[model samples]
Target: MNIVKSVLRATATTATALALLAGPCALPATAQTPARPAALAAAQQAKRPNVIVILVDDMGFSDIGPYGSEIPTPNLDALAANGLRFTQFYNSARCSPSRASLLTGLYPHEAGMGGLDSIVRPGLGGFQGRLADRAVTIAEVLKPAGYFTGMAGKWHVGAQHGTPPKAVGFDRSMFQKGGTYFPDQPGKGRTFVTIDGRQARLDSPEVGKGEWYASDMLVDWTVRFVDEAKVAGKPFFLYLPFTAVHFPVMAPADEIAKFKGKYMAGWDQLRRDRFERQKKTGLIAADATLPDVLPEAYDWDKLPAADKERFDTIMAVYAAAISRMDKAIGTLVADLKARGEFDNTLILFMSDNGGNAESGPDGRTGAAPWGGKYSNIFVGLNWATLQNTPFRYFKHYAEEGGIATPLIASWPAGIDAKVRGTMVREPGHLVDVMPTLAELAGAKYPARFDGHDIRPMSGRSFAGAFDGKPLTRSVPIFWEHEGNKAVRDGKWKLVAQFGAPWQLYDMSTDRTETRDLAAAHPDIAARMTQQWNDWAAKSFVDPWPNKVDGGVIKGRLEGGKAPGKGKHGKGKRKRAAQAAAGA
Candidate 1:
């Protein structure tokens, strides 16, 4: 909770310190990244070959068609079919942190959003939910390098009380600051669509009486921006974070009907079906086994007819949402192809994290969390367990199911065709995104931005893998969301739930984490334990309080001056006086 005046400047020795902490920068394009194509000169790359990062929110490992879901995601599937699908990619186990890491090129904690923008103080680095000035976003980095950056959809990384996307560097944006299942839903509509700095009222026309859906709105804005970029003939960096397939599921009526009874077969069979498809598609080994559902759901057949019907419709709605999102993307890609930008566009598709098992305010009180009669019922735990398929657990944990994300990279002009439509299993994480894009765009991650020296980005460039090169990593990737912690080094991964002992597994063999080798390999466990502890200490890890202990719900930002206790009160009163005078 150490909020203070924004002055965290790095000293003259920052580069040396950051370099030491960051180890080595993954450069030269040959050892780590793919060698640059001779024909695609830096000048040529400097202009065209746009970058499009499509972020899917709260999606599971096996949700889309390419990832072995029955849901039709032809556009996403085409990305996998024409590009490279990653069999072992990772997210930061939740929404905000993942976005923070993806955009910042640092660990989420380094970006000051170790958690959502909920601002729960004194609970580790997560409570400070916004992009720290030091960790400049890709938009920030690329803009000065001459890329027109635009963002659409979720901006959960900084809900409000932080530097906005435009302030951080997006030139134009159509950002729905948060999300709504339907704009017409009661207590809905809170999008902030801006051209430059002026609000365009994409939130609501008159409040609760409109034809608006988050997914469609995002696509609409994205298309408009892309068209503008094309007209301008500038290589644009489009970060379209989709709010689809999350919760309070809403879709067009026709799309909803298309998925009616789709999940009537129930969770049991759906899990097996998706897993088998994954195996066949070579996304997983043929011998991969379906994990036993955690908490063990009741048999679908044993449920009452009414209850069964409810569950079926719930899943159907979820599937329909995905289908609807895919269709919108199809329209976008079609538009891109028509505009002749499809082939040259570097499209990266990713999910924030695995399936969600969260029960929103609607479930808790029979009313929407925002105090509305909303029908966007959470998918709940049973279906979520199935959503994760062969993986275990759900979002918010450092398990495979929580952190694993489906990543597809499509670039007709860049990715080698021989590797197109293939799967790359070399492990990578969200932190790799900024460095990868920086290398691709020839953009420099500044040593300094806004008075603060950047923490040297803690990711090896994975651009080398674009040309079918095996992605290599010399350093272990680490994770800590809430108190859930883990460390992945090479083939061995040591994971643990909050307040639990570490469980070691050879991930190359047990990617599903079906067996724990910690008991057998005492020495390895002890060594990795120390390694994880060192990582935790260096990575700004902090103590997380358990709710049972009754930690403070919210507290003053740490290191901030006391409200009326010093000279701070004068500023607050001055601001209040200005507002009182209508200024």
Candidate 2:
């Protein structure tokens, strides 16, 4: 066995490991447990633990303290200190697609979301820009199993497509389109909050006046929903997807002040610092090597003092956003403990995608917070590189930096004591969430529901990992977004940029994907590509549209709603350099 695996296994006793691994670990198929009788389900619900899935937007693998960042995330760090952390967990690499896959146990395309909900393509089921009716959400399945489901925060999956959280199965929800953090902050689009199922005020007294923060308000409603569940005497399933750390990143002035001057060392030094910390934490393999910085990142020493100072404030704001979210999580965990639900409630925290690099190297900024044109404020490619740490690329690509997410699972009663504080090296994805919850909650996954033929889940349960056992994936994992495509089978990964030839890498040896082995291993590349193509066809993945405009293209192309003064190509770089010279 590999040293890392052996170390992980050693966390548990020989007897415990043997007994758990040898026990019956079969996950129930849809046909096997179609529906439990109402009485039986009610009785089982008493014994079932509450489940809470907390997802953050556009966060990187190393942003939180557990994943090796300087950012203060004592709440998340505390969870990992007493819980299990997966070293290799993945997301769908974007917002809508990832949300769709996470809610339903199918690929984004299979769930009728191949891209952002903002983009729609006619006659294409995959590009329908909505969550498909054929796929059932976790809330939908768990509700029938006697679980009281509630959601708070962003619900971008199918709100525009006429399927809100309440429509899908959440008993209660408080959600919006999720752009602004402060209630008074002006955004280009009007984001209205929906209470339960009806349209409601975004700036309600519940959120307060000037003190209203999105993260705080979201959790307040979550606590309210949990109170309702406790009153009903049903096991709860709560989903809290915060819009923190995404573009137009904002936090309280004092919070932002606390992080000012913390990132003055620049991206080069910060990236190295995070990489070393990640290796020391055993989050990556011992032999893993960091790749060189991308050409898009500017040299820190060469930058003007004014630009550096500005960048520092921008990063401080970014870090403040994460710190604020972490604080909110602390509040939620404390609430759970106070309610006597912390021990049994399985809290799974993760990100929707990797760090966002949408607005180019010098990210867009402006008076959007006070009511100017909505400026998409991001940390730029250089800072995003540091955020992703040892991984290459950022959000909107199939690379590790794009999809790799930090997944922390904590359940004092449900998880084995021996595995606590240990790292699970099992590679898992968002699809696995459904089956994992199903097995843990003893929920029956139905073949059909609500007069519709529901698609069978494409996920395998990773619940065995709670006992320090391997969560073996029988099939390969695949990704396709914005023309970027990739397929990973066992140790081999074949990936390609939009309109580019495939490049293969042996993931077992190089998870960072620095060296391409396509020329040396043609057979493996061909085989995996074929496998990806087959899966894509079945999953309703549409062909590349070959269209580009004022939208996200592929690779190094910088496109978003906040283009700022930076365009693409030499002109963008030239302008940035000229501005730096003036600065």
Candidate 3:
């Protein structure tokens, strides 16, 4: 078994490689940032524990109950209340990139996912639609180590060349390329089922053709996969990434009804309520200030009165989808508990990126028919901004709201009860997931995998944090999606919009990123900026856009507002107006 190396021990080797990065700056180690204790109990309890990673798409930082949402996610909350919560966990600000980073213990670009695959161009080293042969996935690594690796849910990593879940590493895989969550609703995506590398039919009644919800089918099949692993007496690594809460937004009518009037108060009140709950739950600092609306964002009351009911319905569908996902999770957990597998399993819950503000192309481009068809309705910017409560901006930007995500790690036999329900504020990224799981499974990441050379992992495990020990990551975390980019070094973060000037923040105090310290602390800004540029070059990050006026969101140089619209005007009325017209 190749034990995962500690961050402290890898520093010297990484320093030489990243000294200049692709340029010259060395990070100083201050008193260790908060760390997790060693999970000695879980490691020693048995040969290898079952590893399950549950990923949700387009979810905001505070959308779940454990993360301070008004949404009643009892199962998710119970897992968190009995496990660990990461206060500063981050995603890649978009879907496929985030998934790439999570699957491979390397930066997204290094894994050939510089941006969404839809727009990928040939010869673009970073935007290649497939996972590079040089990068080995966690499944690929663990499968060789006496493990049955399986995956069920969204597979957005690659399209051709066996890039599907089973092709990469899973032994028994079920997934769709990417699509709406309501399976019964007709949409533009296809669902494929594969077992032991052979195709399985989803059209059969067993898979639920007439009344299938994505979340329900996922957990149901996953339970069966676990049962197979248990019967064989082999440890399993299951990666379940759900398509819940994405868009076109559909859920069971009863579940939707439960939250029908719940959001009548409007986004402003919802943001305030969530912020208050965050403080009460110790998720954020008690004195943490709430953020003002983004320049393009508008007030809920400002929405046309005629459109109020429709918007409310959209939000209801969203909330209901969340609750439904939680219920399915509860069912999956119950199965584990019933089979006597709950105590020794390590389950992780996280989001692919922040909440989406896209109202589609024309605000109502993909409206869902009341008769149960696949819908592509964008929730628009108002409620999305509210979902990111206390943080500014939404998905597709490098701001805290776009990247921050709720991460819950639960393992009764692995994590110490004393540290359960506790918060770890150390900065971590999705790249850390692969290494962490490999460490727990005692699986070695090889230099060469599957007839090709493998890339070295750019992540460090936080297993020690489970024991309540202070930890320091070997390298700072970096992010880039579209044109939004950020580099977090210790307490300072340098963030930039596509084709915009870089803005610096002292995250130790202003995690909301309300203040720009670039001018005040030019020295820190320069050093971090150099590091960002170097990383961009090394990670295949695209060059800055030519001509400053081409970038999105102007006037951000001084303050955050878009143009004439005040921070709280809601958003450009064109989309909402179109949505109202049912265009």
RMSD of each: 11.6, 10.0, 8.6
Provide the lowest-lDDT 10-residue window in model 3: 574-583
In angstroms, the error of model 2 at 110 is 0.3
Residue 483 of model 3 has an lDDT of: 65
Clashing pairs in 1: 1-557, 1-558, 2-558, 33-464, 34-464, 248-376
* Tens-digit lDDT track of model 2 for 26-85: 235543123223423442444777999999998999999999999999999999989999
Per-residue lDDT over 520-563 for candidate 3, one digit per residue giving the tens place of the 0 to 100 score: 99999999888988888877776534222122332221122232
Report residue 436 deviation for candidate 1 (angstroms): 0.9
lDDT of 3: 0.72
Query: How close to the true structure is residue 241 of candidate 2, measured as C-alpha lDDT?
Result: 93
What C-alpha lDDT values do all the predictions have?
Answer: 0.70, 0.77, 0.72
Against the hidden true structure, what lDDT does model 1 obtain?
A: 0.70
The model with the greatest lDDT is 2
Where model 2 places Cα greater than 4 Å from the true spot, the runs are: 1-27, 30-46, 207-210, 368-376, 547-583
Please give, for residues 1-583, the per-residue lDDT of candidate 1 as tens digits.
1123222221222333344333222233423344455522542434446898999887888899998998888888888899998888899887788888998888878788776766545545545767776688888666555567898877777746655666666767666544365654543344445445456655456222367666766777787788888787667899999878666566666677777777888788989889999889888888766667642244566555655666676777788888878888888888889988888899989988888766410111133221122655567566777788879877777889889999999988888878888888889998888878777665657777656677787787777777777778877889987778888999999998777889998988788889899999999999989998998787766666541122211112123322322322112211100000000
TM-score on alpha carbons, each prediction: 0.84, 0.87, 0.86
Using TM-score, rank the candidates from best to worst. 2, 3, 1
